[model samples]
Target: MHRCLKIPEILLTIFQNFPSTTYFLEAKCLVSLACTCRDFHAPALDLLWYTLEDLVPLLRIMPDDLVRGKLDPSFWRQWSFSRPLVPSGFERFDYYAPRVKVLTRLSISIDSLTLQDLLQLSSLAKLTDLRMILPDDDMTLPDVQALDHDGVAVLPALLDLHVVSSKLANCTALIQCLHRCTLESINLTLQNPPSGRSLGELFMVLSQSACRASLQSLMISAHDELSHSDEDIVYSTVLAPLLLLRSLYIVVIDNSNWPGLDGKSLQQMVLAWPRLCYLHLYTFELGTTHHSLVTLEGLLPLAAHCPNLCTINLGLHASFKMTESLPGRGVINRNVKLLDFGHSTIDIDAVPHVAGFLSDVFPCANIISTWDEDEFEEDEEDEEIAMSTAWDEVISLHPVFVIARHQERFAY
Candidate 1:
């Protein structure tokens, strides 16, 4: 690199040209740039410290006494603090700590995180987004009580948190800590959730968060089905107060028992949370098989009111005969360009009508639904083709239906 290229602005522009996933070179390039000159130091350093994937960089800055654990200094990058160790120097958190404001993603085993480690992570002053993962061998139950101790609590300003394969007790502590932190989003994935009774208590804790009003996105998923007889708790009655919420995802992998909404209640949600831009609901139960649980009639309130809604994913009871339409509601959503029905099942009988209705509302949008080769019944395949033809026909000024070709990338 030339001296002129070391101008902070020029360097930033050049570095930013690399994709955000340019993780392969982000650390090396930014660190090298920071060492070049005093002028390039702050900008390059800012970029380098903006995301701390691990504690190795910080380990390099620590006083020798702090790391008395006979481990190699370089070994800290892959080290796990399983033993009861509290290095008393959080106040000594380095100069670059404040620059970390985005996803402070740390891949670690929950069992390996001692009180000291958890407290250390909580003390990331500027952390807004964080994701913690449990390694494959971490079968030990988590200690939730310690997570809630005043000695180690989350500070306000942290917004997004995601915990995968963690215990319900751990999740409870994290949610209860919301009162301390002004969090907006929470995502949890449990391979095995607790009993329905305990699960309800966990949800109640979240619904009653001190910062519930500030919450905007909440995603609770599980590999196993979470069946609740009291489905009302998962609906608008509990979440309606989050008027600022923009995205909501409730997915139960291959489980049909997840809670759902009817036309009236769904309408109420659309009215209550006008800011909702994304709403995804997944379940194995086929609404198309049973016509009453969910109906196309629900689309009335959505198309009429939700102007900011850009994406929707809900199972619908498709019918061959189109439902009655609103006579005078001319409202059209401009921002909603994607409609996903990944969890929705299309009725073989009503493919054309469903296509026509979807096209009528989102004329320029792309539609996504479940697509499987082996599971495709002959009747459904022909209907799907017919639906696509209907969609393409209405997309253009002319009646000619042209299929769009799309190439999807599978890997990062």
Candidate 2:
């Protein structure tokens, strides 16, 4: 082989160019290259095992007699051991497990081996990003307990954790497992709004654990109906502890109301993160009776602080009265490119004032708002239509104000 072909970077680039649109085809081509010579074996195998969407490929490495499931087509992606697992079955598993860096779409079945069994088999030393769907029905008390022992994380090197589930119980259990790892990003989507206790525990684990110092991005979304009790837990109480995470650059919370989120609370939250670049807090979906206590005035602090902030979305009640004496009158934030106020109501008469105010605060921001078509009632349709029209007017009128402000500044 030529000296250039021997270079690791050159070989990797060549392997990357191989067709990847088809998994089995790519695997076959890599397998052929691996068999061709000892030089190509290691790198070929590394790319093949770099990302495992599921554990099926790893389990396929075991001896045919040791594991079973070919009897039925339903269990194609799943398998169970025919007999008690022995160390010999893990020889091939041990070799390839260390190569995995990203694991996603992992599904745990109640009938199959538990997470504890997998963790015991290999530490997955190189696994850095893990996304799993933890079914509440498949998880057991012992399975979760297995991860809580000795303060040792199952995936110690994990940095980004993404959990999407309809239930909060299993999601909470999985998060508790990573207390020992300093995860940099956490994206959680739950169908049900977490109870105050669950939310407290979740925040507590992130704040008190190794994650507090290293966490940079957090995105939590609850897609179910909000109850009166759920409304009482203010966002500040559950999320304020995160202020210690000075490295936080992005924060997103959707359909979760912050009952007491006023100008003071907003100011405190925005000021806590100097590196904040994106702030998206959609407290209430459109057409809902619920509205944030914050008005357009609440956003003034964002202009003064958060220099790196570029994308902003907040639910605020915009009215002409507040616009008359808008806070941070002269303060400007040119970094902001788009301002999305979800389900926020705007008085028809206040469109011009709100537009000019936003232009002054976020001179470069493009204002937009959206409503949930499914949430509006027949009687409220007219009101929502009016609100949508008013916000549309603001969007149209904003650029004119932006130009006029620039001219005024130059004239000064």
Candidate 3:
């Protein structure tokens, strides 16, 4: 009888030592073990709760009927799933209130009311990191604005906040909110056109904040409808205030209308960002006319200003004539360690010219090109396979760097 009891104990010990049992998997097994005997019940319950705390989304998505599931009644008895799990609203606070003390990082999809509830979750006062992803629609603006309003006063411990929205008005509000916090870094998507108030409001907020001095990184995207004049104003007002910015990424979405920046204005802005080290730019369908493609010419002068720039990414749409005028390899800074170029067609013959230009500009940097045939086939399978292969190849080749692609690359 004693040997029989020892056999079960040895089996349980072996299961606990299994290398493949991850935290989540182990927790599930513990639930089963707890149901078998009173001796395993208390310890298993403790392990289950500890593991579930690390997995917050499971709590958010746990179904109401989970309590009635066929698995085990005791497991459900200890677990709390009565509170609502919607991304926003009062129930979110009630559900998280007990567990917030242990949560150091949280990521959630944003809706209009979600931001409001997050603001009221005072338990998150100890949270060090928060990431909110907005839907790709009009709601993005209001959601971001709500966070912007409460972000300053509520999140004193927050070190990073990433907001993706589709309105310039929300971007303006986000900037204003950052002014109130001592944030170390931010990633934002500004997907709307530069309207009158949004543009001025963003600049006004940045100019007033000491947060600009503390910010180390920034990522911004603008709608293609913004005029060259508007872009110039943005660079001068909003970007100029970020005097201490180290890493920068600017993506200009290609609306049917091709928007290009003025060469002289770009030159001034590039020269002003002295602390900038990494720069990425994505431009789509800017016109073939003199006014449209002149922005590409500004690259030469822009490279000259950022002596410390170590990485550069450029995505553009251009005709052969515009490509020919592209300043050859010499304009690239020697300090640049990674160079990415996309959208320009490069045949075997043109590869050397492209490579030569890159070698001239950034001689010490590693050059990786995503060269594709000029003709694209309509086969969906081929496209899917090609994309999967391209992503895998890029990831394998460039581990620590990013590859920028034109907006058209995703358009069907």
Candidate with the greatest TM-score versus the true structure: 2
Return the TM-score for each candidate structure: 0.58, 0.73, 0.52
Please write out the lDDT profile of model 1 over residues 16-63, one tens digit for every residue: 675555575777777776898777788877777777755556655555
Give the residue spans of candidate 2 off by over 4 A. Answer: 1-115, 137-151, 193-197, 222-229, 286-289, 320-327, 372-375
| Per-residue lDDT of candidate 2, residues 141-211 (tens digit) | 33545556544466677788777666666666666666677889988877766566566677776777788
Candidate 2, residue 109: the lDDT equals 38
lDDT of each: 0.55, 0.74, 0.48
TM-score, model 1 to reference: 0.58
Candidate 1: segments with Cα more than 4 A from true spot: 1-107, 112-122, 135-153, 166-170, 192-202, 221-255, 285-292, 320-331, 343-349, 371-373, 376-412
Let me know the TM-score candidate 2 reaches against the reference structure.
Answer: 0.73
| Clash totals, every prediction | 0, 0, 4
Error of 2 at 142 (Å): 4.8
lDDT of 3 by residue, 1-412 (tens): 3454345455556556655446767767877877977666644444445322234444444455432323221121223444554544445445534433355566655555334554564456666566655555554322435555545355666667666566655545544544556666666655544443354465466556655556666555554445434443333344344433333333222222223434564565576566567665544322212234332345566567778777755543221222544334345476878755443222222333333344444556775444343443445445434433443343343322222111222553
**RMSD, each candidate, Å?**
10.9, 7.2, 12.5
